[model samples]
Target: MTMPHKTIPESNHAKPVNLRIREDVRVLIDRAAKIRGKTRSDFMIDAAYRAAEDTLLDQTLVKVDAESYQQFLDILDRPPSGAGFERLMNAPKPWQG
Candidate 1:
């Protein structure tokens, strides 16, 4: 008798990634994955995710808990201060011609 398998739920926000690497780099990737007992795709995805998380943490981001989230929502509910906006809007454009 065969055992029944459960189906995994699908994700809605999947994005396709395609990258080109040099031949030497491809060889190095295979070697690294073999040493770690992980597939090339797994290693690459893990590395990319770590790099992405680091980048987001280094930027101007507002992180908050549930209570703070409500406060944040209320803050955004108000109008903008027009901070640095006028300078950018009225700034002279460089000559492109």
Candidate 2:
């Protein structure tokens, strides 16, 4: 005889998060979440995740020689590339029609 396997739900892996926020802050978050059609928990999670990524990015340090730094500045001083910006500017505007 074989034993049946047990199935686990995704919620089992999730941990509860508690926040002690001001009533005004809670209302503001609820408004923003409603505009985006997401539950308050989902909106808060997305915001917290993005903030974490930004915090991580801020910790990164790039090392470059003096010559490389000047080259980077020189590139920044140049005008925008001629790939498609010019063409887009000259393109017809439907709003005017």
Off-target runs (Cα >4 Å) in candidate 1 are 1-14, 60-97
The most accurate candidate by lDDT is 2
Residue lDDT tens for model 2, 1-97: 8686332334657889999999999999999999978789888887887788789999999999999999999999998869597888889999988
Against the reference, the lDDT scores of all candidates come to 0.77, 0.85
TM-scores, in order shown? 0.45, 0.56
What would the per-residue lDDT of candidate 1 be over residues 15-88, giving only the tens digit for each residue? 77899999999899999988867789777776677788779888967667999899888998986658587777
Q: How many residue pairs clash in each candidate?
A: 0, 0
**10 residues in a row with least lDDT, candidate 2:** 4-13
TM-score of 2: 0.56
In candidate 2, position 75 carries an lDDT of 93
